[model samples]
Target: MTATIEQPTKVRRPRATLQLLRITLVLHALLIVAQPIAAGYFLAGNVDAMTDIHATIGGSVWIVAFLQTIVAACYTIAGHGRLWPTITSAALVIAEFVQLTFGYAQNFAVHVPLGTAIVTAVVWMTVWSFRSTARLSRREAKR
Candidate 1:
């Protein structure tokens, strides 16, 4: 006579998702805060020039930066299961490109470089993440 073997329930699935979200959290938050952070970096190089630019562009840059970072956070956390992250991430990408266009026209040299880099990185990451999310949603829907 042979005994039957049974499998145990798994716990790593959701944890993996959370882990992925945490990466987005760390990277997004750090880059989002780069407005003030980069100002400090630039200050060491040219305090007077950076100070003037920070005073003028700081508010708008920080607002968009933080908001988009939040959106990225949302994307990583619940994006694979819902539709909002997809919409918000799409909007995040579009809004950022628009900002980039306007900012470049205004003079990329004078304004903060970190803002441009952050926005660009967010746009690309958001787009890629959204594609993954769309695939997952489709798979889920079919099931």
Candidate 2:
């Protein structure tokens, strides 16, 4: 009998939407980390304009959060990834909106603690998204 050659298994890659989600999540995490630094600069009397920069970054975060939410939804539906990412991103959008509102209202009581929570959540998501567990598609997940 003729010898049979075994074909090499194909290496699967993440979908474009998943890749986009990872980019957005990393960007979001970096921005979230910057918020505390910017706030510290303003608090330290280093730069008077840091308040404006802080606010600008906060606004940018809102836009990014919204975009991330959409991408997370797409990843879940089309890419067949987990649904938690979509829920988490949507919650972040709401939380960020609240954070901006309280920040503008000068309610440090809520703003400070909430900012800490948001940063923690974002960092957690960013870390998780990079892990193999988060990369598991529905088929792989079932396996």
Candidate 3:
């Protein structure tokens, strides 16, 4: 039997990449929540009680969010996808500042819900934009 290679599907945003982006957004959002909770604990009792887990999670989330930021930029630079590109860029900007301002990666004591809400809203907007743009393009193509 002769073996044949199947060509990979062509897509502006592949399933895996989209899934990764989604996961990164979710993780970052969770960090936004976790940071405030951790701060509450620190305020209530001992600051020493905070563990490396906070830092580790925050760091990993930061990296993931950074990667998504790059992906969003790429999507815009390439000009292949229009809908999510705009939303993603906005979200990335907010996320980057939030991470830096809140000191989420460096310390959990600083929690900024303003930034969190901005990022969260942008994430959902990006998702909605992606779906709407996709549908619009399909419809346009049919005509």
Top candidate (lDDT): 2
Instruction: Work out the TM-score per prediction.
Output: 0.38, 0.85, 0.49
Candidate 1 wrong stretches, greater than 4 Å = 1-13, 39-80, 107-143
Q: Which parts of model 3 have CA positions greater than 4 angstroms off?
A: 1-16, 49-60, 74-79, 83-115, 122-143
Greater TM-score among 1 and 2 belongs to 2
TM-score of 2: 0.85
Clashes of 2: 0
Best by TM-score: 2
What is the overall TM-score of model 1 with all chains considered together?
0.38
Compute the lDDT for candidate 1: 0.50
The residue ranges of model 2 lying beyond 4 angstroms of the native Cα positions read: 1-14, 47-49
lDDT of 3 by residue, 24-138 (tens): 5565566655655665676788665355544455455555566657765444445344445445556666665676556645543445555455456645644654463432332
lDDT digits (tens) for residues 1-143 of candidate 1: 99988887432222344345445534554544555555676657877645566444543544554555565445445554444544555565555455556554666563446465555665465455535433354336456
